[model samples]
Target: MDIKAYIESGIIESYVLGLATPQEADELQRLSQTYPEIAAAVAGGEQWLRETADHYALPAPEELKTQLLARLEHEFQPEKQAPDLRYYRRDLFKYAAAVLLLLLTVSGLLNVYLYNNYRNASRDFVRLQSGIDMMAADNKAFQAKLAVLEQDLRFITAPGTIKVPLAGVSGREDYFATLYWNTQTKNVYLTANHLPAPAPGKQYQLWAIVDGKPVSAGLLNPNCTDLCMVTPVQQAQAFAITLEKTGGNPTPTSDQMVVLGKVKA
Candidate 1:
């Protein structure tokens, strides 16, 4: 396999971001074990992400350590009986080391996942914050928008949500996106996760093939959040996105199709 091409496909980003499905994750893990280049890429990505997050890390409160130690002391206290000093000391050190190691491992893993989520949320917040600050925004309006996003997240993470990876077409190998389709609800949501900003007066449009005809799913807004709701279809055999004139076209211009993916059976 082409290691460089695999790395450039954005699967690594999706995996690091916790967006890849179980199958995809399993495949990546297998590849990482089989290929030195993949293993290096994954490790490098994790290290770079950790270093980037360190700049934004906040210092813990002074009292926090004291409280943690106090709790640990209480938990490891001897029962209502005389204790062996040397044995107690040895066990105490062992347990303490184990606890510390566990905490560090969990914290590192949590930080990676949380950092990706925080980055996405921060982008959305920054985009709207300026307008909110200028308008002295209505709390209800803000909450409503937030509620919608929370709902979308629930749908995306819900069990049975099918993740379809869309790859860039000819001449646009770097462009990619994902489709989260809920079979039960027949709801389709599109995320322009890695696609570059379209040129002026051009926009990306999504299409779903149903009954041998192409149906416009929706026109993607470049400025929209990572997840955007597209028109729901009862059924689709495939999905494709194309760059079209602003406001989109009645039908996709074949020559302009940027990415496409077939729906799994």
Candidate 2:
């Protein structure tokens, strides 16, 4: 059988309503088994009938359908309803477009919010990273200072650590100085800051007074703000400094005295 031509005749639709002659029903079954196209045509006809009934958008009253079916069965008649077909496809399209636009708006907003959050997160991460680096640098400096203090503590506990007191003279009201030294270790630490800076071409020389005779140790120009360091010599009793020639004087010229200290260290 030519399936397309058979469908054009509407026999497939008539067969779904159980109105086909006995011979025609048998022919339909045989054609369905012989060609897949015939089976598809039959299915398509049934679906079309259902969709056509639904297109009206309303069901017949239940009692009306029952009564109609009973009359068709009793009279052995073929009946088809011609009901009103009103379409709202345009309205449905408008509703669908509105829903699609709402979805798009929500999606775009979510994307922008997430982008802003990612940018803020990146900024916060960079700030935390910089703070961590600064903390690491501080920790390194603290560790270095700790090591120097450990060395100082060890030397202070050793046998003879002389604590010498160096007092200020003229030009200093009540400012004082001190020196901690270990002659055996030849290490000295000078602490004095209240003394004013010396005039240009003049400086303060440290003298290790031994048996009323003074020996040159080192010089402080008064410009040194940091604690001055001195080399400890053996048999030193006192400390003094006098303004001498720029390189320093081999002997004290007495009148150029800036400061003198009797070492009771």
Candidate 3:
């Protein structure tokens, strides 16, 4: 079996991204135990996802917590009711029976009013609880993202990782990118530093020059805002990128070349 070809087929990526079918994921798990290369590729892909997620992670606004607290305080606040002073009437002895009846009627009406208020308060409390539950869910999600970001930072900063800068070619001098190559594991990661958005239905492709021939590393996602993992190239003399169609071509177009850089010796 061609291990390299299988690794480059993007099954590992799909598995890492949760896009692989259940059967395919099971097969990948079985294969990874038998092949170290597959296992490494899977691990590398996960690290790339974490790193990318970290790069794009946005912190919560500084005033968000204060605003949420203030809103809640205002929403659940109790309303004050003034005391009834009609009970202390001047003609108390003249209409005792009438006053007693009026008092009974008023008591019944107050009970009904209080009951309705309790019901409404219960409903509002439920709605507020649902919102709290949603916010809790969001908080958990953010915590998970923070954990991934930490892991990504540790992975990228590990020893033996080499950074290769790819400068723009002539007439495209402003474009720039960087390649993170793990020499120990032969894993390659790409980060687009500065490049214009691709035209409609167009994309960028990466190439690794090996022995004077260009090999397809992989295609770059134009909307990629963070680190991107490309196909591992163990014996590349240099790396370059060229504009290509949406899905990319088997060979890079020479005239469309945008960036090129050599691997340091």
Assess each prediction's global lDDT (C-alpha) against the native. 0.87, 0.76, 0.87
Can you give the lDDT of residue 151 in candidate 1? 94
Q: Give a tens-digit lDDT track for model 3, residues 1-265.
A: 8989989999988998999999999999999999999999999999988998899999999999899998898577445433222444534644887888899999999999999999999999999999999999999999998886776565578786778899999999999999887777778888899978899989989999998899998999766677778888787888999999999999888999999999897
Residue pairs in clash, model 2: none
Question: In model 2, which runs have C-alpha deviations exceeding 4 angstroms?
Answer: 1-101, 170-173, 200-202, 221-227, 243-249
Runs of candidate 3 exceeding 4 Å displacement: 1-100, 112-120, 123-127
What is the per-residue lDDT of model 2 for residues 105-218, given as tens digits with 9 covering 90 to 100? 999999999999999999999999999999999999999878767766666666677777777667653655666677678776666645555678877677888999998887
Q: How well is each residue in 215-251 modelled by candidate 1, as lDDT tens digits? A: 9988897778668888787788889999999999999
TM-score of each: 0.44, 0.55, 0.55
| Alpha-carbon shift of residue 10 in model 2 (angstroms) | 34
Off by over 4 Å in 1: 1-149
Q: What is the RMSD of candidate 1?
A: 53.6
